[model samples]
Each structure stands twice: as structure tokens, then as C-alpha cells.
Target chain A: MSPSIMTKGAIDCDIHPSVPNIEALLPYFNDHWRDTISQRGVHDLQTIAYPKNAPLTARPDWRPKLGMPAADANTISTQALDTFQTSIAICNCLYGVQLLMSEDLAAAFASAVNDWMIAELLNKDPRLRASIVIPTQNSEMAVAEIERVASDPRFVSILMLVMDEKPLGRRSYWPIYAAAQRHNMPICVHAGSAYKHPVTSVGWPSYYAEDYASQAPAFHNMVSSFICEGVFSEYPDLKVVLAESGFSWLPAHLWRLTKFWRGLRAEIPWVDRTPTEIARDHIRLTLQPVDAPPTSEQLERLMDHMGSDEMIIFSTDYPHWQFDGVDVIPDGISKELATKIMVENPKNTYPRLQ
Target chain B: MNIQLMDRVATDQKIKLAIADCDIHPAPKSVPVEIYPYLSKRWQDYMETYGIIYRQGFPTGPAFPKGQPNAARRDAYPPGGGKPGSDLDFMRSQHLDANNVQLGILNPLSCGQGVQNQDFSAVYCNAVNHWQIAEWTSKESRLKASLMVPYEDPSASVKEIDLWGGDSNFAQILLLSRTAEPLGQRKYWPIFEAACRANLPVAVHAFGYGGAPVTGGGWPSFYIEEMVGHAENTQSLLTSMVFEGVFERFPTLKLILVEAGFAWLPALSWRLDKLWNRMRAEIPHVTRPPSELIRQHVWLTTQPMEEPEPREHLLDTIEWIGWEKLLFATDYPHWDFDEPSRALPIRVGKEQKEAFFLKNALELYNLN
Candidate 1:
């Protein structure tokens, strides 16, 4: 009955495999990319997207003396997998590949990141899975990248930034979704952005805290765009995993969204079912950084509002200081709900995992 | 016949709380031109020649598409053909009188608070305040108006507050949640200081014509996105105000966050307190716990009331946000307006119902 009782063999739906530097990716890259990196002097194009030194980016204990925090497979395994007894951990590398301006360079880096992820992390651990990072700036190139990685069973999903060049629901992005649906790859919309626009609608925020808090609204917008633009209806089989996007806000958002959609349904007649039904069917949110109240009872109340336990998939958000040391699953979660979040929910969401 | 008689008896037996609707949005009868009378001839010519300029490049309208025309309920439009909230008689019959509302606070969102031209914004805001007094409050004794001010220009805003703050007809200083800068920034402290001096609680309604997107990121793709987007902006503003020591500077200034439902309050407050505990060194000016400041200075209106699954969760959240801080709101004429008769949960005790529906707002605005 205790909240801390670990749900053994749980699946960690989100774990970041830090790309140490551009130089670290040299081996996976072709000779042209290697020479281009050297010629251009592309020294760590890593952005403040996940600021390297941010306390939230990496726990103090997880930090390595040198290089990036989760640079080594051994470190991630010890800190994330072994510690949580994770049966599977989906590696989502949030490097600045999407931030690159040039399509060619962005495409090249995306491939190299995936290749490096497989070699450095997935190959080392059989239980590890990954989301294929795609060049969102170029839809065709993004599809090409998805096609290239489709055969790899370890690559369970296609990773994307929430704030891209355009809303993900726009037709321009359909090819990527089409490729994902064809490959049974769920589109994983991660918390960080491509910085295509100001983090807030008003303009850039003055503080990192503002930027951090902005992620929820970004996710909400993306979800709205997806539902309104008929993305879920168009690609019926397509699933979305909102990674590092907290779960507590979902119930309220869905409630408000459904309320508006009732009066506004005529605007988008293509959306046949209710907004909540569409979201409940297609969307899955990761559970780390739960963003719930301090106590277990409060968390239970939030979960009750969410309506169903199936929407939350377990995630440590490894190397990120979301939860304290062994409190991977925050308080207020019952053992039954924890089991669903950690095991059953992830399996139901990721078709490839099954 | 027996069932009908029983139903009528049950309805008659139900208790009705003295309702103080905190967020009643009264639209202009026609257009922004309604305020032209209160402006100077030169300014009137300026308004006629050039329209209000917002900061963003998007077209002048709501960001997302609405389900109804002007996003108002179909039943709310007047029979004579005007905007939903524009017709005062219709509003009273449909909302105030029908609901037995004791006091209705008018928050006119169309006053153009986020105009880039400071002087024009001030003039427009002043006109809107006068219009509210003339068009709504004076006509209906149960109604009260919020003093409108161009928040970007602190001196002008203060001046406007001083001009209208003493009026018993106006209960609070009206501000849009989405301003050019976070409301807590020192640039805005002057208005807060003026409000404190006038003993007027600053009321921030969700959404504004601020050229900024409602979210921290840019404009949302859909209206649905924009619809749920207010909470994020509200959260940032709340954090900015608390962390920047606005409360410490003006201890008497109270804030009422309207239309941005209360469910997020407990979580946001907890998060702010958590971050403040660890990062207190960064903002040493914030003397007390962030949660403590929130409890002391902030009040939230209930509209778009959160329908958590079990429904009991909402009651628990209200407990987290003290019952005394909740003000009942209907967001009248809009499609999602809550009927006061059925807005609160049925199980609520009469005392709690009275506190939420009337007492809290009365205390905040010094109605008693």
C-alpha cells in the first residue's frame, strides 16, 4: 500500500541520451559530415533547449565529472534502468538537430544522432528503445529519415519538438505523419522547441523558469492543433506520446477543450467524435515531472480527473531532476495505478513494444 | 401531475445564495467607436483616420475561430440585433435578474488594453471606463464597473486609476492577464501602488488583445488551443508577480484572476513554492514563501470550473485554494457561461456556497 513500493519491471517511456558534442557523433557520420563538422567548426550546437548546466537537465548525482551527464550507456543503465528496475527505457535524445537552419545539416545531424543512439545506447542494452529524431524543417527529408529507421525495431517512434516551423497538424507535416503511421511509429512530441518562434505568444520570456513553465502550453497547443486539423481522424492509427509534458494538466485541458468544441464543432465538422474521445484514443502522456500536488491524496484527485489510467505511461525523465532520488514514482499513486502507468499503459500505447 | 407538483416543490425549497458575479463582460453596443464621444476632437480624428494598433501583425480579431458568431451564445443575442453583452436590458433579464445576482462586476475586454500607442491606449481606456459607468452601472444599481487603465504606461495608468479609483461605482482596476510585460515587472508597480492607495483590488480577466500569443510560445494553431491557453499566461504572470516581490512592495494590493479556472492554482502554487525553496537566492527580494503571498494577495473566479472526473477532486482543490479566495463568475453572454443556480456542486453546504458565490468577492471589494 505504500506509495514508494516500486512497480518492478516498469517501462520508462522517456530517457534522454545526451549527445556529448558534435565530435562525439563523428564516428556514426559519413566522411562528408565529419569533414563538414570540422570545416564549419560546428562545436556543440547544443542550445538552451535543454541547457547543459540546468539543475533540471541532470541530477547532481547523475552528473559525470566530464562530458555530458548521460553520455555513457553505463551511466544511464546504472542511474535509470538498474535503479528503477526498468524493463524498457525509450531513449529520446533532445539535441539541437532540429534547431539547425540548413536542411542538409539538420538531416545529417538527425541521422548521426539516431545512429549514435543505436550504437551507444540501444546496442548496449536490449531493453532500450528509441524514438527516431527527424528533420522537421523538411518534411520529405524527415520522411526519408523515418523510412531509413523504420526497419529498426528498437526505434519505436518518431521524435519531434513541440514548437516546430509550423503546427504539426498542418498538411505540410502530413508526410512525416503518413510515414509514421505506415511504420506503426507513434509521433513523440517532446517538451523542448526548435525555437522557430518566441517561447511565449507575447515574446521571449525573461527567465528559464518562464521557458520551463511554457512547455505545458506548448503541448496543449500542439494537442489542439493535432485534434482540430483532423490529424487523428486522418491517420486513425497514429498515436502521440507527449514526453516530459506533465500529466496533471490533461484533465482540465480536455474538459475545457471539450466544452469549447461542443459549441465550436461546426467549425471543424471533420472532427466527428468529441475532442476528449479523440485525445483519449490517440494521446499518451509521460508521468515523470507529474506536476501534481505535494501529497499522494492530491495526486489521486488529479488522476481521478484524468478519467482513465490508460493515458499515463511511466517515465523517469532520466538525467533530469524531476523527482527526488528514489521517488521515481511520486507519492499519492496507488500500487495498481503505478503498475498501469509503468507497465500496462506503455505497452498499450507503443504498438512496437507489444 | 403528482411528479410535476413534487418537482415544483423541490425547486421552491432549494436555497439561493446572494450571488456576486465577479466577471460580467459587457460589450460595446456597436463597435470601438462607442468610446469616441469621450475622446478629444483631435484624437477622434486620429481614431477615424487610423485604427488602434496592436503589437502583433495578426488581423484584428480573436486568434481562433469561434463556434458562434462573436463567440457568444445563440440565445444571448438581443432581439433588436446587437452584440450579446451590448444589450443591458437583455443581460439583466437573461443573467442578473434571472439569477438573482446582488452585484455584477463589468469587465469590458474590448477596451484595448494592449495598444502599442500609449496615449491612444490611455484615452481609449478612459473612455471605456466612462462608457461602463454611463451605459451599464448607472442604469443598473446591482452592477459595478472595473476602472480601465492602459497598463503599459504606468504614470498614465496611475492617473486613470486616481481619476476613477475613488468612485464607489467601480469596485476594482481591470487588467488583462496577457500584458506586454509580466504584470510583476517594476514598470507596472506604479499602477499596483495606485490601486493600493485607492483601496481597489486589481482584477485580471483571462485573455486580452495583447499582440502576444496567449501561451508562452507563439500563437496557437487552433481556437481550441487558444481557448485552453489562458492558464499558461496566467501562471507566468502569477509567478512573475510573486517572484518579483510585487506583493512585498504593495502589501494591500489584491488580485482577482478571472475565467482562468482554479484547478491549476494548487499545482502552480506548489511548483512555485518548490522552486522558490531551492532558488530563493536568485530572487532575494521575495521575502515570504511564494504560496504564502498567493494565499494573501490572490483570488480566483470560478467559471470554466474544472470538471475533474470524480468531481470531488474539484472540492479538494477548492480546499487547497482556501474557500475565502474563490469568487463566483458566470462569464455572461459567452457560450460557456455558468448558470449561478447550477454552477456550484449540489453537495456544497449553504455557508460554503454563500462564501464562494458572494461573501468572498464582497470582502475583497469591501462591499460589506
Candidate 2:
């Protein structure tokens, strides 16, 4: 079911652009990457290589026809605004763009992508906002790209694929954070469609579903790394949004991480506040692909640990298989709290919205 | 034959239908003042130890929310709640009546604490086992017991098993799921071998009786989160037993996994078979499919069967895992214990219902 039309603006923090065809947009990217895509070796992107301005096909799913003739500003605007009724859509580059470029070339490709998204997609619809993609594999280039796009109001935050090279807290990536802080934008860390990292200490996960179930462990490590390395301390005003990550795992991670911190405070004396305290202040988490959606009782128990509603921000990793629909938000939570998750908390983080 | 006489006489074929709970815990009435009663006099004199005690009913530590002395600690400590740390009257009143089962096995919470104390594990385990026999197990006809042992010290563990074996009421040797080493290793053979000779089955229960660090981290504040992933520990336990040739060496030995729900068995079975075939060269002794050995010797309980998928699906899972291998359990008084009648709903058709609820447990636990 569709959400009720909001009397006030309803900001959508996440929206995935479905790419069912990609043959058209290949050449729109710079010609310097002729050998790069071939060397990267992701066959799926290569097989459906679309040429620039070729006639777009309406794939059965409403994914973008990348190599086909572009839908002009008006057609794209109507679908993103009138059809979806989203006041602001946080758009990003094509998910597979990085796979085609080396770490250095990826930064160039990222700048090219931001240029395309800002000029074509964001410029078309007043409601659409963009998250500037960075070449996460190379921090220096990523910082440069962030600074270049920092002045653009259409660009809201730095979009990070969770499995990107180096977690958010690594010293090499500090410059990228400095760039985001300089521009007053948050970093939006979203899950990627990769599971090559060791999800848990136990062993490699046995099934595809188990791998999906392990997003918490990944998010937990990122949160721990951020807190332990004093990332939040360094960037007191900068916010971090764990997008497309589930909410239930947050309370457990906060409790355990903070409790361990109490026993071993010497390990990280710089982290003055408890992990939860740091999280409530500088961090926000979204709730799509909620691994263990609680019953009313479970929700109350979880809220007890979370202590405040502001800790979570609402998101639907849209058009992906595990998206949350309108009715799934239970009436058990107070309307004010629900509104905070759905709108207010996100506004606090992504301030460039209409 | 009278019930007591028939209990002794009934063979595997008869299946005279006694519902036996393979796992149940009886917490200590009080942590004993004297930890090392049997230590050499010289050693005892040298060691006047600081053992944890139950002030109200929970273990006393330095303090609570603050590092308050005992006076302030009393205020913060949870009111000596349900069953007073495995009080028998509480177990019988809350569990026995609710489950309507014939027998309840008493596992000890402090047994793990004793095991962790290293030097004190042996004497402490002996004292707790004797206390269970005299106070809890002997008091009720329907109440049986499992002997806890000093798991780190294998010979001491075996001795504890032998001490309890003479008593028919002691049905199983209780092992904690979290141990220093895998049970299948050669180091644990003394304990398993002793269990075989004593004619007592081995039951491994989860270690989270009171703040035993769970697998991945420190203790979970909520019990539900700690309990959900318990089956993985049990799977580890079963793999250790099967591949270690515990079952192959002692053909009649039975291994029971307590409190870990039976739902994981089907998926685990498939995965084990895959691993056993792939790593067959490493474990030269385990020639057969791991599933076959598991079916032959291992059994599991269904306690706190949280939110079962449709009854048909529940039965479908059982069918896939061989229904006869499961035993009904009510992990009663521990906050989230399932009511047997409520948990084992009569939704499944009559034939499979009796097997899961009563018959299979009786056959496996030798409580005919």
C-alpha cells in the first residue's frame, strides 16, 4: 500500500535506481576508461554495455535503460515526483560504476557520475536530491571529489558502499570525513551486494540468506571502528547515517560494545562517551531489511535499551527485494516517534532537503 | 509390573510410555560455605577461599549499578525472584504441574561456577551432586538428576560420574556447552568413557545459567537474545561427539542436547554430511554420513518453541529430521520457558503428536 499523501513534505532518505538495461550510458562516461571496464572483469556490466543516447527499452522491471535514448527532464521528473510522491529522493551513481574502474580511475568515474546525476537527474526534478559517490578505494581522490561537489546544494552526503575499501574509521579516510565536515554534509553508509569480507569470527557463513542475515555484524564492526578510533570525537558536528542497515541489531551492539568498554576503558581513553551515547549524538540508523522485526513486546524491550526514538531514522532501500512497505510500521509506537523516524531525524542529518 | 519395577524392567521394544524430561535445572539452595571439604588438611588450612554466596538468592558480587558495598548492593539486586535459584518446591509447583510430565531432571547452575574455579571444580561438583541426590532428586518420584563434573580436569570429571552412577535416579552426566576444548578431542575421552561405563547418558546444556559469556561476546542482558542462537552451540557439541568417535567407541552411549530447540537439526544435518564427505581424510574414523551416527546416538529437546510456523510446517521439519529423535522439554521458571501443552500443541495429527510429546523422550532416556 502507498503511504498517505503528506500534508507536510515527506523526505525519502534512500531510493535505489533500478538499472535493467545499461547499454546507453557507457559512452556518457569518459573515453579514458576504454580499457578499464575490460580489466575490471565484472561480466554482467560488460554484457549489457549500453551506448550513449540509444533508444531506451522499458525492461519488465522499471529499471533504467542505461545505453538507450534518455527520457528527457519532464518524463523523469513525473515518475520520481508524481508517481512516488517523494518530496526529496537521495540519488546516487550506478551501483556497478566502481567495478569497472581501478582505485584511481574509479575517482574519475565517480566525478563523471556526480556530474551526470547532478546535471541530468537532480536538475530535472526539484524534489530529487543527490548523494555524491566517492572512489572509496582511494581516499585522496575521494576527498578531492567531495570538495569539488561540496558547493553543490543538490549533493547532500557522501554515499559509501559498506564493503568499500577500508571501513569508515581508518586513518586514510579521515581526509574524506574532513571534506564532508567542511561542506557540512553527513556520510551515508549503505550496504553493498557483496559478502567477500569475513562477516563473523566463527567461519564463512553457510548460505546466501545467512550472509544477508550477517549485515548486523558488518554494521557492528563499522560502528565499533568509528567509536573506538574516535571518529565521532574528531567530527563532533559531522553525522553518520547507517542506511539500509536493520534497526534491531543496534540495541544489542550498543549494549555489548558499551559494556565491554566499561571493562576495558584503557583501550580507548579518547572515547569519552559510551558507544550508545556517541551513537545518539552523532549517528543515525535506518530500518530497511529489518532482520528481526519485533512483536509489540519485543519493540518495547528494544526501545528500553535505545532510550530515545531519535536513535533511528526511517529508510526503505527501495526497489530492492527487502523493502519496507507503508503498513509495516506498527501502530504500537507513538505517532511522534514514528514521525521522527519517518521525517524529522533524517531532516536533522540531511539538511539540504526542501 | 508395578510402575517402579516396570521402570527398571522395560526394554527398548516395550516403550511403556513414560514422559522423561532429558534436561531440567535445580539451582543451589545456597552456595556451600566450605568449598574444598575433601582437600588434604594441610591444603585446606592453606586455602581459606573466597567463594561466591547467595545473599538473597542471586550470587553476590562486589556490588551492583555502582560499586556499592553489600548494603547498597541489596537494593539494586533483583528481588530474589522465581523458584529461588532452582528451589524444588518452586520447580514442582511451577514446572511439574504445568508440563504434566512424569520426570524432571535437575541440572545445576552453580555447577559451571564450580567448574570455572579450576582447583575447586572437583570437590565443589561432588558436593553439588550429592546435594542434588539427597535434597532434590530423592524427594520426588518423578524427579531425576544429571551429575555435573569438573570438565577441565577430565579424571576428576570421571570420578564424579562414577560417584553418581550407583544411584538409579541419576540419569545423565551434565556437561556445559561452552568448554575449554571440543568434546570430540582426545582430552575429553576420559569423561565420555566414564559416562559410558556408568551407564549414564551425556547431556550438554547452554552455559548461560548466570552470565557465562555467550559465544560471540560478554553476557547478554536479555535472556531471549542469548537463547535464540543456542542451537549452534549444540550443533558444535554434536559434531564434536560424532567426529570424535564418542558414539562409535561406546555404541550404547546416548548424547542429549538440552534446551537447544530441535528446529536446527535438518539444516545442520545437511551441512554436516557435506563437511564429513569433504573432510573425510582428516577424520579417518567417521566413515558413515554424520546424519546416520546423529540419528543413532544423539537426541534433542524442544523448549521455548518460540512462535512455531504453522503446525504442518513444524511437523514437516520434524519429518525431515526424523521425528523419533526429538524429546519434549519445558525449560520452566526461566522467564521464557514453554508450557508443554501450549508448546507441543495438538495441532499435528494424533499419530506424530504422542511421539514428540511423550513416547520418544521415554525411549531415548530409558525411562520406559
Index of the highest-lDDT prediction = 1
Name the runs in model 2 displaced over 4 angstroms: A1-7, A19-22, A35-84, A97-101, A193-196, A291-294, A297-301, A323-325, B1-368
Task: Assign candidate 2 its CAPRI class.
Answer: incorrect
DockQ of 1: 0.43
Q: For model 1, what share of native contacts is present?
A: 0.35
What's the CA RMSD of model 1 in angstroms?
3.4
For all the predictions, what are the DockQ values?
Answer: 0.43, 0.04
Top DockQ: which candidate number?
Answer: 1
Q: Which ten residues in a row have the lowest lDDT in candidate 2 chain A?
A: A47-56
